[model samples]
Target: MELVVNSPLQNQIVGGEEIVSNTSRNFIEANTKQVTLEHLRKDCIIPVFAKDNESTISHYQFVQKTREIAQDLFPEFQVAEPDIRISHLIKGRIPSAIGKPAKELLEHEKTLYYERCAFVMEIPEVVENVNGNNLALTIGGVRAYNQENLFSKKSPEKFKVFIGFKNMVCTNLCISTDGLANQIKVTDVDQLSFAVEGLLQQYDREHHLGLMERMSRYLITEEQFAHFVGKLRMYQFMDKSEQKKLFPVSLNDGQINTVVKNYYSCPNFKRSDDGSINLWKLYNLFTEANKSSYIDNNFERSVNAYELTNNLVNSLQSGARNWFLHN
Candidate 1:
């Protein structure tokens, strides 16, 4: 079936332009125009494939552009080699012989699909003294695959760029879903570097340092963690208000609690010696949960969870500030 996008933003952007057709069976064809991060969020159309003779950028080019932007922004800091990985979605077929060896059964594997690509580059670590102990600030940019699948009718295959931070002390990576500030979509090769630089500018030294200081000073208490979990549970049962528009479907209470449990039990999420949690830990919990929780194997569901959790964290931060002011 030919997939159709029902987004108003997409219609506005296309504006009666002819969509270039492609021969790839699973690929969706679209115009070869440059789209901003705003366009990606609203339109849900990704311009990954271009028409014949049209210039297109590869994943390697994207990494190079990111490195250039990082160098330009922080000349003193060195951009390390990017750690690259690929995800493969495969369908297993029944083996002809039931008793066949595992190695021989592998030959019967029918199809392997290219799911997505991801890469992370670590920036120069910042050392700070926190209560007579040295803490390292690990900052980097993460590029992950966002694309259309059988379940996702609106969103298309595109790469998403995120600026992430991790304090070695907590070993938790903090990510935000504020596309307007922290995220960007790669549409045009020419605009890739500019888009990355723009995100970096938003998280300038002063802003980044302030957040680091706040996280260092405020240790999350058991009460605060409970409050954050309560907010997530509220999302599960909240009325079909703004959330309905954002999430395709609300997560149930069981699913919410399972995610919370995973956060506390996961070995990767190490708690501080003081037994206090922080925003970084909370943020990592959601991101890690998204990695494992797949709704009917639909990629869109995972993406929605990631975005929802990010917004939740942002709200939690605002609530914390308000509490501090009142007390």
Candidate 2:
């Protein structure tokens, strides 16, 4: 069985609202390139579907509708420009009997479209300072080519949306289960809007923030950190049945290596002189390491990091015999 986690701060009912988000950003290892909202509305081509298949929601449609919902939900808060990223450019030439050469017409006559996109918009006015790190209220949704099923009109399209605290110091999103809506399937703007509103209303901001505050209070010494790291490194090598008895692993080998490297050198989140790091710092380190993941996997990995770190904090406090955290 997995380690039993108990946190007083969770579900304590100290808040309101939910979060929706799309992708990760920190000027880190994302393959996505920044684009403006206008670009999607004006330049990007919505994918064409086969006769029996219905068209999925366009990138612009999902993002714009979410923006509208955020405004309606939080009318007093100022919403920032949609921070958009797009990738996998698909360009093709339409058949044309050009007077010019084919070589010259190839680049000029091609229609362009992106296969995947995601965006985040910050509500700067709704802010919180947890241990000197400024976290703004952030909402965003992700749309990728893999989520679309163009072969069947009967299949509903899936979209992932999230909202939570955006760590201002490092720009790593602090997401929890209460703030995310993954695989929320909808066919149109109205359905998507309803899903977003439901997600928003379900979030408990005060409780989520309180959990972070609690994490900031617990400290893990460097020795314990090394021990924990060793256990985590061994997790993948363990037999499947044995591994299944505990929590599923979150970081890959490279991400784990990155976490270890950043523990000693991360500018804002490294350990203290006494070789101790608070859980909140460890949480950031996890999110920071998560930057190496692909865009599609980013949202899930981010949530996993939060869950793993929260478990560790509980493990630290309860003196539980967690395989990863205890001897």
Cα lDDT tens digits, model 2, 177-267, are 8888988987677888999999998999999999898999898888889998999899978999998898877689999998899999999
Top lDDT hit: 2
Candidate 1, residues 55-108, lDDT tens digits: the string is 334455666677678778778877765544333222233445455543454533
TM-score (C-alpha, index-matched) for candidate 1: 0.51
Candidate 2: TM-score? 0.87
Candidate 2, residue 295: how far the Cα is off, in Å? 1.3
TM-score of each: 0.51, 0.87
The top-ranked prediction according to TM-score is 2
Per-candidate Cα lDDT values, in order, are 0.43, 0.77
Q: Model 1 misses residue 262 by how many Å?
A: 6.2
